[model samples]
Target: MVGAFEQALLALMIFVIMLGMGASLTPRDFYLALKRPYGLAIGVVSQYGFMPFIGFLLITFLPLPSAVAVGVLIMSCMPGGTTSNIFTYFSKGNLALSVLMTVTSTVFGVLLIPILLLIYANALDLEIPRENIIATLVLLLVPVAIGMGLRRLNANGGAVTEFMGSLLAVFFIAFILISWVPRNWEFLLTTTPATYVASIALGVCGIAIGYAFARVLRLHPRNARTVALETGIQNGPLAIAIVAFTFSGTEAQSYMAVPALYSLFIVIVATCVTFIFRRANTAAEQKMPDGLL
Candidate 1:
């Protein structure tokens, strides 16, 4: 069973993360969303649409345990993580579009996540508590609203948001290194190859499909890259919190494994993808005249 302290810690971490997200936002951010609604629309659709189906298909075909399958589904249904914003910046993608999509997806995820989980859980014959999921998602909005209010009132709120973002990254990396990975070392060693494939494929397909859809819809090249990163980097911490709250004992541990592993793997893959995009962008700049670039 997860200890009471651990549970409380997870809750606090998620709250801080959401607060940081809201603090990062401004009134102008919403204005941008309104100004270019199509990019946001395409991103939201790609995020909530094909990703869940990909998770469903993976678990359906692979011989994964029920807990692991449900974990993957939860991760799939989550919103885009702020990590995507970093990746988008490095890739020379549309940073504003990336942030807008992240905010929009997260807000929409409050409703869409539970609905998607219900649909996929039913299809897979997995038993999940819809009420608990709904309650947890609702709780997430409280801190976010508080942070947004702070940003609206204070001119220096961006500094606080940046601090929170740094804290989140540090806390996650420290927790995983000092606690989670050591505790789950045996499970990591014994995990099946198919499970690894599924986790990696989830991130891969998210990027590919998101970019493909955006390009098909004739979005700008920068917007297409932003969509891809946003789709690929899911809110793994949120998924972890959901699993931690919803399950206990061996079940909780089992369910937690997929998201934890995916979190680590996705970073590596996203880094590689960012590098490729950076090289391509550099090459394009060289090809263009001084003023054209």
Candidate 2:
């Protein structure tokens, strides 16, 4: 199990990270999302559709233990986080679409996550605590609601909070490295090769499929890149929070292995993906976004 201090730190990271995600949006964003609905469609098809199938295939083929397999399922089903938005900005992708997709996927996740978990968990004969996960996800929304209200009330304060959330999303990675990794160095070292491969492959495969899916639809290169990162880079902090809060002792640690490892590896994965995306940016595609990213 994660140490108490680490769990507390993880909770704080999630609260503010969610708050920032909330602050990044306004009421108009939702209106536009409904009007356009493009991002929403993409988010649902790519994230809720393909990603879980990928996870199911991975766990089915790989020799992951039951707890570790469930961990992978949870990671695979997560929504795109603010981390994807940051990467979309850096990659010169469609920031507006990225944010919309992140928000859309996350909102839809509240309904989809439990259903998806039940389907996959049942198929695999895994015992997932879906009710606990459901409660945690719903509770997590409180911060988003608060952040949105803050944004509506004070623009400057909202921006500061938004920036804090993105910065802390990155900082959460550092926290895991310094705080979680050291304490669990022995566990990490002893972890099987298959577990490591599953952790790393989830993001990599998700990105590849996302980019390809976007291209198939003839999306602009920037939008395609945005979809790719958003697809691959899931909300790791949320997954960690879910696992940390939902389970305990050896069982919790076993369940945490995939999410924790994925959180650590995804930064590296997204960095490389971002660089590739940056190179793919055409001068025309660079000018495609109407100034949102």
Candidate 3:
């Protein structure tokens, strides 16, 4: 019971930190979101539609236990990264699309993640705790909305936003580092070679499967790249919190580790992939004038 309480507290802290980072945006960000409706929709489709199906399919094929399978599925229900916008800008993809997608994904996550859990938990014969889902939504989405609202209301709030955002980012990272370092330290060190291999394999599979779906849907290259990264980057920290509080010491915890590792792997892959796509886009742009290629 103590472990569960600790885990919940840590998750809450991280969620708050993420929200704080988001609050630094200006009202222009919201207007920018409206400019690229198609890109936003494509991102949503990749997250809410393509990735979940791919996760379900992967879980079915893998030899993982039921708890892990459900864990994988639940992680898939999460949205694209808050930091994906930075990568998208660096890669020279459509910036408006990235921002809109991030906003949409974050909002939808408040609803979809819980519904996915309810469905998936039932499949795994696990009980659904509605309160946990509500708490998570409040912790994550509320701060984001508040930040956005502040930006809209105060034209000169950027400095304050940055201050809060930076502090929150530090808080979130510290919270995770302090708690997770102690709790999962032994597991991190003693994880079998097979476990590392499995983690990488699953991360790769998520990218490949999500990319395939995006390609099939005939999404634009920019959207395709975003989907691929989003698919690869499951919310591992969130999954860990769920395992700790809701199902500590159960088989679920072991399975949940896959998502945790996946989050780390996805960040690395996204950085690499963003550069690759950026280089390609730069080469193509150089061939054409007026940014048309």
* C-alpha lDDT of all candidate models, in order: 0.80, 0.90, 0.60
Model 3 local distance difference test score: 0.60
- Report the lDDT tens digits of candidate 1 across residue range 111-177: 8888898999999998888798888889888887888888888859755775686469536645665
User: Which pairs clash in the backbone of model 1?
Assistant: none
Best by lDDT: 2
Model 3, position 242, has a per-residue lDDT of: 53
Name the weakest run of 10 consecutive residues (lDDT summed) in model 1: 284-293
Candidate 2 lDDT over residue span 1-293, tens digit each: 68888888888889999999999989999998898766689989889998899899999999998889999999999999999999999998888899899999989999999999999999988999899999999999999999999999999999999999999999998988888788777888887788899999999999999999998988878788889999999999999999999999776777888999999999999999889877877677656644332
Off by over 4 Å in 3: 1-13, 21-37, 124-131, 159-182, 185-198, 209-220, 241-245, 249-256, 286-293
lDDT for residue 194 in candidate 3, whole number 0-100: 48
Rank list by TM-score: 2, 1, 3
Taking the tens digit of each residue's C-alpha lDDT, what string does model 3 give over 1-293? 12656665766655554554466555576565566566566667767776666666666656655555655666667676545555566666655555566567767787877777676566656555657755766666666767667656774574476455545433443454565546666766765554455556655666676667767877666655556665665545555555555665535446556666665566567678777877677556545442100
Error of 2 at 89 (Å): 0.7
Measured on C-alpha atoms, candidate 2 has an lDDT of: 0.90
